[model samples]
Target: MEKEHKHHISSYFAHGTVLVTLLVLTVITVVVAGLKLGPLSVFVALIIASIKGTTVLTYFMHLKYDKPIYRIMVFGVFLLFALIIGITFIDYVFR
Candidate 1:
Protein backbone atom coordinates (compact mmCIF):
# COMPACT_ATOMS: atom_id res chain seq x y z
CA MET A 1 0.00 0.00 0.00
CA GLU A 2 1.31 3.42 -0.93
CA LYS A 3 0.41 6.42 1.14
CA GLU A 4 0.33 9.83 -0.50
CA HIS A 5 1.71 12.74 1.41
CA LYS A 6 0.33 16.23 1.11
CA HIS A 7 2.72 19.13 0.75
CA HIS A 8 2.27 22.85 1.09
CA ILE A 9 3.91 25.04 -1.50
CA SER A 10 4.95 28.59 -0.76
CA SER A 11 5.50 31.23 -3.43
CA TYR A 12 8.90 32.69 -4.26
CA PHE A 13 7.53 36.14 -3.53
CA ALA A 14 6.67 35.11 -0.01
CA HIS A 15 10.16 33.79 0.60
CA GLY A 16 11.64 36.95 -0.89
CA THR A 17 9.55 39.02 1.49
CA VAL A 18 10.82 36.98 4.43
CA LEU A 19 14.39 37.43 3.27
CA VAL A 20 13.93 41.19 3.00
CA THR A 21 12.39 41.33 6.44
CA LEU A 22 15.29 39.39 7.96
CA LEU A 23 17.78 41.68 6.25
CA VAL A 24 16.02 44.75 7.59
CA LEU A 25 16.08 43.27 11.07
CA THR A 26 19.79 42.55 10.79
CA VAL A 27 20.42 46.15 9.85
CA ILE A 28 18.38 47.36 12.76
CA THR A 29 20.31 45.11 15.12
CA VAL A 30 23.59 46.50 13.83
CA VAL A 31 22.41 50.07 14.26
CA VAL A 32 21.17 49.36 17.75
CA ALA A 33 24.49 47.81 18.71
CA GLY A 34 26.26 51.05 17.78
CA LEU A 35 24.25 52.99 20.33
CA LYS A 36 25.53 53.37 23.92
CA LEU A 37 22.50 52.05 25.74
CA GLY A 38 24.46 50.04 28.34
CA PRO A 39 22.42 47.14 29.70
CA LEU A 40 19.50 47.98 27.45
CA SER A 41 21.65 47.12 24.43
CA VAL A 42 21.77 43.48 25.48
CA PHE A 43 18.02 43.40 25.97
CA VAL A 44 17.45 45.04 22.57
CA ALA A 45 19.78 42.61 20.83
CA LEU A 46 18.11 39.61 22.48
CA ILE A 47 14.70 40.93 21.44
CA ILE A 48 15.82 41.25 17.84
CA ALA A 49 17.45 37.83 17.88
CA SER A 50 14.25 36.27 19.26
CA ILE A 51 12.27 37.80 16.41
CA LYS A 52 14.73 36.48 13.86
CA GLY A 53 14.65 33.03 15.45
CA THR A 54 10.84 32.93 15.40
CA THR A 55 10.77 34.02 11.77
CA VAL A 56 13.22 31.30 10.80
CA LEU A 57 11.28 28.69 12.75
CA THR A 58 7.89 29.71 11.39
CA TYR A 59 8.66 30.22 7.70
CA PHE A 60 12.08 28.84 6.84
CA MET A 61 11.52 25.72 8.92
CA HIS A 62 7.88 25.43 7.79
CA LEU A 63 6.65 25.23 11.35
CA LYS A 64 3.78 27.53 10.47
CA TYR A 65 2.11 24.83 8.42
CA ASP A 66 2.84 22.09 10.87
CA LYS A 67 0.41 20.61 13.39
CA PRO A 68 -0.65 22.55 16.44
CA ILE A 69 1.10 20.08 18.75
CA TYR A 70 4.39 20.83 17.06
CA ARG A 71 3.85 24.53 17.57
CA ILE A 72 3.07 23.95 21.23
CA MET A 73 6.24 21.90 21.67
CA VAL A 74 8.34 24.60 20.08
CA PHE A 75 6.76 27.18 22.33
CA GLY A 76 7.55 25.06 25.35
CA VAL A 77 11.18 24.81 24.34
CA PHE A 78 11.40 28.54 23.88
CA LEU A 79 9.78 29.08 27.25
CA LEU A 80 12.33 26.84 28.91
CA PHE A 81 15.15 28.71 27.19
CA ALA A 82 13.72 32.02 28.39
CA LEU A 83 13.41 30.80 31.95
CA ILE A 84 17.02 29.64 32.00
CA ILE A 85 18.23 32.93 30.63
CA GLY A 86 16.18 34.85 33.18
CA ILE A 87 17.57 32.80 36.04
CA THR A 88 21.13 33.36 34.84
CA PHE A 89 20.55 37.08 34.63
CA ILE A 90 19.08 37.20 38.08
CA ASP A 91 22.03 35.33 39.52
CA TYR A 92 24.48 37.65 37.78
CA VAL A 93 22.74 40.77 39.02
CA PHE A 94 22.79 39.60 42.61
CA ARG A 95 26.38 38.41 42.55
Candidate 2:
Protein backbone atom coordinates (compact mmCIF):
# COMPACT_ATOMS: atom_id res chain seq x y z
CA MET A 1 0.00 0.00 0.00
CA GLU A 2 1.11 3.52 -0.80
CA LYS A 3 1.85 5.86 2.06
CA GLU A 4 -0.40 8.88 2.32
CA HIS A 5 1.24 12.27 2.10
CA LYS A 6 0.70 14.41 5.18
CA HIS A 7 0.19 18.08 4.44
CA HIS A 8 1.73 20.80 6.59
CA ILE A 9 -1.64 22.55 6.82
CA SER A 10 -3.28 19.54 8.40
CA SER A 11 -0.45 19.24 10.83
CA TYR A 12 -1.14 22.77 12.05
CA PHE A 13 -4.79 21.98 12.58
CA ALA A 14 -4.00 18.81 14.46
CA HIS A 15 -1.51 20.58 16.65
CA GLY A 16 -3.94 23.34 17.43
CA THR A 17 -6.72 20.91 18.21
CA VAL A 18 -4.53 18.93 20.54
CA LEU A 19 -3.34 22.05 22.31
CA VAL A 20 -6.84 23.40 22.78
CA THR A 21 -8.11 20.09 24.05
CA LEU A 22 -5.22 19.81 26.48
CA LEU A 23 -5.90 23.26 27.88
CA VAL A 24 -9.65 22.70 28.14
CA LEU A 25 -9.26 19.35 29.84
CA THR A 26 -6.60 20.66 32.17
CA VAL A 27 -8.92 23.42 33.29
CA ILE A 28 -11.73 20.95 33.74
CA THR A 29 -9.54 18.66 35.83
CA VAL A 30 -8.49 21.48 38.08
CA VAL A 31 -12.05 22.64 38.52
CA VAL A 32 -13.25 19.15 39.23
CA ALA A 33 -10.48 18.60 41.73
CA GLY A 34 -11.63 21.65 43.65
CA LEU A 35 -15.27 20.57 43.69
CA LYS A 36 -14.89 17.71 46.19
CA LEU A 37 -16.77 15.02 44.29
CA GLY A 38 -15.97 12.35 46.86
CA PRO A 39 -14.64 9.06 45.46
CA LEU A 40 -15.79 9.92 41.98
CA SER A 41 -13.21 12.69 41.70
CA VAL A 42 -10.46 10.20 41.04
CA PHE A 43 -12.54 8.39 38.49
CA VAL A 44 -13.40 11.62 36.72
CA ALA A 45 -9.77 12.68 36.54
CA LEU A 46 -8.77 9.29 35.23
CA ILE A 47 -11.46 9.44 32.58
CA ILE A 48 -10.18 12.82 31.41
CA ALA A 49 -6.63 11.56 31.36
CA SER A 50 -7.74 8.56 29.38
CA ILE A 51 -9.38 10.80 26.83
CA LYS A 52 -6.24 12.84 26.45
CA GLY A 53 -4.11 9.73 26.15
CA THR A 54 -6.35 8.27 23.47
CA THR A 55 -6.31 11.56 21.57
CA VAL A 56 -2.55 11.54 21.56
CA LEU A 57 -2.36 7.90 20.55
CA THR A 58 -4.97 8.11 17.83
CA TYR A 59 -3.82 11.40 16.32
CA PHE A 60 -0.26 12.29 17.32
CA MET A 61 0.79 8.64 17.36
CA HIS A 62 -0.96 8.02 14.04
CA LEU A 63 -3.04 5.09 15.15
CA LYS A 64 -6.32 6.36 13.79
CA TYR A 65 -6.08 4.48 10.50
CA ASP A 66 -4.43 1.46 11.97
CA LYS A 67 -5.92 -1.98 11.43
CA PRO A 68 -9.23 -2.93 13.02
CA ILE A 69 -7.53 -5.47 15.23
CA TYR A 70 -5.13 -2.85 16.46
CA ARG A 71 -7.99 -0.57 17.42
CA ILE A 72 -9.74 -3.42 19.18
CA MET A 73 -6.59 -4.32 21.04
CA VAL A 74 -6.05 -0.77 22.21
CA PHE A 75 -9.63 -0.45 23.39
CA GLY A 76 -9.42 -3.82 25.10
CA VAL A 77 -6.35 -2.72 26.97
CA PHE A 78 -8.09 0.40 28.25
CA LEU A 79 -11.15 -1.62 29.28
CA LEU A 80 -9.02 -4.12 31.15
CA PHE A 81 -7.24 -1.38 33.01
CA ALA A 82 -10.51 0.33 33.83
CA LEU A 83 -11.91 -2.92 35.23
CA ILE A 84 -8.87 -3.39 37.43
CA ILE A 85 -9.15 0.14 38.66
CA GLY A 86 -12.83 -0.31 39.34
CA ILE A 87 -12.20 -3.40 41.42
CA THR A 88 -9.58 -1.67 43.49
CA PHE A 89 -11.82 1.33 43.97
CA ILE A 90 -14.67 -0.84 45.07
CA ASP A 91 -12.48 -2.63 47.55
CA TYR A 92 -11.13 0.59 48.97
CA VAL A 93 -14.52 2.26 49.19
CA PHE A 94 -16.09 -0.76 50.88
CA ARG A 95 -13.29 -1.13 53.36
Candidate 3:
Protein backbone atom coordinates (compact mmCIF):
# COMPACT_ATOMS: atom_id res chain seq x y z
CA MET A 1 0.00 0.00 0.00
CA GLU A 2 1.19 3.50 -0.85
CA LYS A 3 0.59 6.52 1.34
CA GLU A 4 -0.92 9.50 -0.39
CA HIS A 5 -0.05 13.04 0.56
CA LYS A 6 -2.40 15.95 0.04
CA HIS A 7 -1.47 19.60 -0.16
CA HIS A 8 -3.64 22.67 0.16
CA ILE A 9 -3.10 24.93 -2.82
CA SER A 10 -6.08 27.15 -2.37
CA SER A 11 -6.36 30.35 -0.38
CA TYR A 12 -9.18 31.32 1.94
CA PHE A 13 -9.80 35.00 1.61
CA ALA A 14 -11.62 37.35 3.94
CA HIS A 15 -15.18 37.78 2.83
CA GLY A 16 -16.16 40.84 0.75
CA THR A 17 -12.64 41.97 0.08
CA VAL A 18 -13.18 41.17 -3.55
CA LEU A 19 -16.61 42.73 -3.57
CA VAL A 20 -15.36 45.96 -2.06
CA THR A 21 -12.47 46.12 -4.46
CA LEU A 22 -14.81 45.58 -7.35
CA LEU A 23 -17.11 48.38 -6.20
CA VAL A 24 -14.21 50.75 -5.78
CA LEU A 25 -12.82 49.90 -9.19
CA THR A 26 -16.22 50.29 -10.77
CA VAL A 27 -16.57 53.73 -9.25
CA ILE A 28 -13.14 54.70 -10.45
CA THR A 29 -13.93 53.46 -13.91
CA VAL A 30 -17.17 55.37 -14.04
CA VAL A 31 -15.65 58.54 -12.67
CA VAL A 32 -12.71 58.37 -15.00
CA ALA A 33 -14.98 57.67 -17.93
CA GLY A 34 -16.90 60.85 -17.24
CA LEU A 35 -13.84 63.07 -17.10
CA LYS A 36 -12.13 64.39 -20.19
CA LEU A 37 -8.38 63.96 -20.21
CA GLY A 38 -7.94 64.57 -23.90
CA PRO A 39 -5.80 62.02 -25.71
CA LEU A 40 -4.54 60.57 -22.45
CA SER A 41 -7.88 59.46 -21.09
CA VAL A 42 -8.09 56.36 -23.22
CA PHE A 43 -4.64 55.28 -22.11
CA VAL A 44 -5.41 55.94 -18.49
CA ALA A 45 -8.68 54.04 -18.65
CA LEU A 46 -7.00 51.08 -20.29
CA ILE A 47 -4.24 51.02 -17.72
CA ILE A 48 -6.69 51.21 -14.88
CA ALA A 49 -8.92 48.61 -16.47
CA SER A 50 -5.96 46.32 -16.86
CA ILE A 51 -5.22 46.70 -13.18
CA LYS A 52 -8.77 45.83 -12.25
CA GLY A 53 -8.78 42.92 -14.64
CA THR A 54 -5.53 41.60 -13.22
CA THR A 55 -6.89 41.83 -9.73
CA VAL A 56 -9.98 39.86 -10.65
CA LEU A 57 -8.12 37.23 -12.61
CA THR A 58 -5.42 36.82 -10.02
CA TYR A 59 -7.65 36.58 -7.00
CA PHE A 60 -10.94 35.33 -8.32
CA MET A 61 -9.48 32.89 -10.77
CA HIS A 62 -7.09 31.56 -8.17
CA LEU A 63 -4.17 32.15 -10.46
CA LYS A 64 -2.11 32.95 -7.41
CA TYR A 65 -2.44 29.38 -6.20
CA ASP A 66 -1.78 27.73 -9.51
CA LYS A 67 1.31 25.73 -10.29
CA PRO A 68 4.54 27.23 -11.57
CA ILE A 69 3.55 26.35 -15.10
CA TYR A 70 0.52 28.57 -14.80
CA ARG A 71 2.66 31.46 -13.77
CA ILE A 72 4.93 30.82 -16.74
CA MET A 73 1.94 30.76 -19.02
CA VAL A 74 0.77 34.14 -17.74
CA PHE A 75 4.24 35.58 -18.05
CA GLY A 76 4.48 34.28 -21.58
CA VAL A 77 1.20 35.86 -22.54
CA PHE A 78 2.16 39.18 -21.03
CA LEU A 79 5.61 38.98 -22.52
CA LEU A 80 4.18 38.47 -25.98
CA PHE A 81 1.78 41.33 -25.46
CA ALA A 82 4.58 43.54 -24.25
CA LEU A 83 6.63 42.65 -27.28
CA ILE A 84 3.81 43.65 -29.56
CA ILE A 85 3.23 46.89 -27.67
CA GLY A 86 6.92 47.69 -27.63
CA ILE A 87 7.20 47.08 -31.33
CA THR A 88 4.20 49.23 -32.08
CA PHE A 89 5.55 52.08 -30.01
CA ILE A 90 8.99 51.82 -31.51
CA ASP A 91 7.58 51.87 -34.99
CA TYR A 92 5.21 54.73 -34.23
CA VAL A 93 7.81 56.84 -32.47
CA PHE A 94 10.50 56.20 -35.04
CA ARG A 95 8.30 56.79 -38.05
lDDT of each residue in 1-95, candidate 3, tens digit only: 64554544443463268767878888988898889888888888888788877887777776766666777899799999989999999989999
Mind giving the per-residue lDDT tens digits that candidate 1 earns over 57-77?
999888898777779999999
Compared with the true structure, the alpha-carbon lDDT of candidate 2 equals 0.84
User: What is the C-alpha lDDT profile of model 2 across 23-76, one tens digit per residue?
Assistant: 899999999999999999998998999888988888776677666676888889
Please name the candidate that would achieve the greatest TM-score relative to the true structure.
Answer: 1
TM-score of each: 0.84, 0.68, 0.72
Scanning candidate 2 in windows of ten residues, the lowest lDDT window is 2-11
Q: Note each model's CA RMSD in angstroms.
A: 2.8, 3.9, 4.1
Point to the candidate with the largest lDDT.
Answer: 1
Cα lDDT for residue 49, candidate 2: 91
Clash list (residue pairs), candidate 1: none
The whole-model lDDT of each prediction reads 0.90, 0.84, 0.77
Q: After TM-score superposition, what is the CA distance of residue 41 in candidate 2 from its true location, in Å?
A: 1.2
Segments of candidate 1 deviating more than 4 angstroms: 1-5
Clashing pairs in 2: none
